[model samples]
Target chain A: GGIITQTPKFLIGQEGQKLTLKCQQNFNHDTMYWYRQDSGKGLRLIYYSITENDLQKGDLSEGYDASREKKSSFSLTVTSAQKNEMAVFLCASSMDNTGQLYFGEGSKLTVL
Target chain B: SQWGEENLQALSIQEGEDVTMNCSYKTYTTVVQWYRQKSGKGPALIILIRSNEREKRSGRLRATLDTSSQSSSLSITGTLATDTAVYFCATDSNTGYQNFYFGKGTSLTVIP
Candidate 1:
């Protein structure tokens, strides 16, 4: 069984700083996704990639950017961190976008 | 717009008791997925129910879908403390191939 690994599980950033979170999956799935979850909130899609070098924006992609440089990795960037806020960013991959999704542990970001 | 709405009520149940959570969606969806997320952990898909299939089960978990009502339910029997988590229901029915939409989840606490 392959694993999806997210880097720097805990991240601290200053207000207005640009923060990047990285995810790597060895499942070799064709689709990669980025989502953000606030406390007591559901997951909101930020961005997703259907293949290598592809990008698609989601409902919450306004303040974020994503890149799929390779098939096995997807990364998300927060353009400007909000002060005194915290959110968990999750990375997921799927063999098909409409099928079962596998998720990475997550990256917790705290903006100071 | 395809969106899901899960009951926001927080449930507390004793271990080994049965619990059920309900979710309603708007729009015609091809597939529905149920997921669980433990504290500080990423969400994982527990079951996927299609429009045609009314019910599916995996171990102690059972899922039921009602296409006419555009609603679904997840039932867990003989619950364990480890089963305490937030459960979310997501849909894959989009406007001309759109991204999945999720709703705020139901939080369940299995008390010992």
Candidate 2:
């Protein structure tokens, strides 16, 4: 069995500060995704990488950037943290675009 | 925008009772996936139904899809308190480059 690990389970940032979340999957999946989850709002896709060095924007990608430096590692960056913002950032990987996804526990972000 | 509207926003039921959640999408999809998210964890795929298949079952969970109506339903029998979580329905709508679009989700609380 493979696992998806996300770093810094809890993160605190100041308003306007930039934050980065890292993810690594041992499943060797070809597609990786970053999603922001807010309570009662469901999960919103921020960015996804179909392969190494490939990036695709989702509906909620305006304030975020993503990088896929290697097949097993994908990272997301928050351009500017919003004051009092709190949400969970999830990292998920799929074997392909049409397969099941395996997700990390998540990285909780709190902006003060 | 391709996401479906879930039937119930939230539900509370006894541990041993049966429960069902419904969702209806607005666009054509090749597949629909049901995901469950427990508190402090990322969502996990529980069941998936394809356009050609009308029904699929796994253990105590059953999923039904109606392509003509663009709707799907998930049923769980003899629920346990551990089943309490938020359920989301996702569709492979092929919207943009992103493959899956998810609904707001149905929050279920199984009272033990």
Candidate 3:
């Protein structure tokens, strides 16, 4: 079995501050994704990468940037934090685009 | 607008009771995946029903897909406390990219 690990389980940032979240997976999967989950608002895709060094934006990618520097790791950056913005960011990987996805525990962000 | 936005439905039921959750998507998709998320954790896929398959079951969980209605439903029988969580439905559009969309989710509380 493979596991996906996300660093900094919790984050607190000030308004306009930049924050980064990291994810790693040992599944050797080809697809990685970052999603944001807000209370009562379901999960929204921020970005996804199909392969190393590849990036694709989702519907809610306006304030986020993602990187797939290596095959096993994916990272997300919040360009500028907003006050009272609190959400959980999830990282997931799949063997292929159409296959089942394996996800990390998540990184919770709270902007003050 | 989100593609797979589940009805903002929250249900509280006693153990041993049966429950069902529904979701509708705005676009055409070839696969619908159901996921369960516990508090402070990322979502986990419970069932993946394809366009060709109308119904799928796993242990005490059952999922039904309707292409004509662009909707899906998940049913749990004889629920346990462990079943308390937020349930989400995701769709794989096969849009020449790995674009999987997730709904907001339905929160279910199984009371003991």
Choose the strongest candidate by DockQ.
3
DockQ of 3: 0.75
lDDT of 3 by residue, A1-112 (tens): 9999998999999989999999999999999999988889877889999999999998889988899999999999999998655799999999964568788999999998
Please give the TM-score that candidate 1 achieves against the real structure: 0.95
Clashes of 1: 0
For model 1, chain A alone compared with the true chain A gives a TM-score of 0.95
What 10-residue stretch in candidate 2 chain A is worst by lDDT? A94-103
Q: Report the poorest 10 consecutive residues by lDDT, candidate 1 chain A.
A: A93-102
Cα TM-score per model: 0.95, 0.95, 0.96
- Candidate 1 ranges with C-alpha deviation above 4 Å: B96-98
Candidate 1, residue A11: how far the Cα is off, in Å: 0.8
Give the per-residue lDDT digits (tens) of candidate 2, residues B1-112.
7575575498999999999999999988888899999988889999998889999999999999999999999999999999999999988756542457788899999999
Error of 3 at A91 (Å): 0.7
Q: Give the candidate order by descending DockQ.
A: 3, 1, 2
Report how far residue A94 has shifted in candidate 3, in Å.
0.7
Tell me how far candidate 3 lies from the true structure as C-alpha RMSD in angstroms.
1.2
Clash-forming residue pairs, model 3? A42-B104
Model 2, chain B: what is the TM-score?
0.93
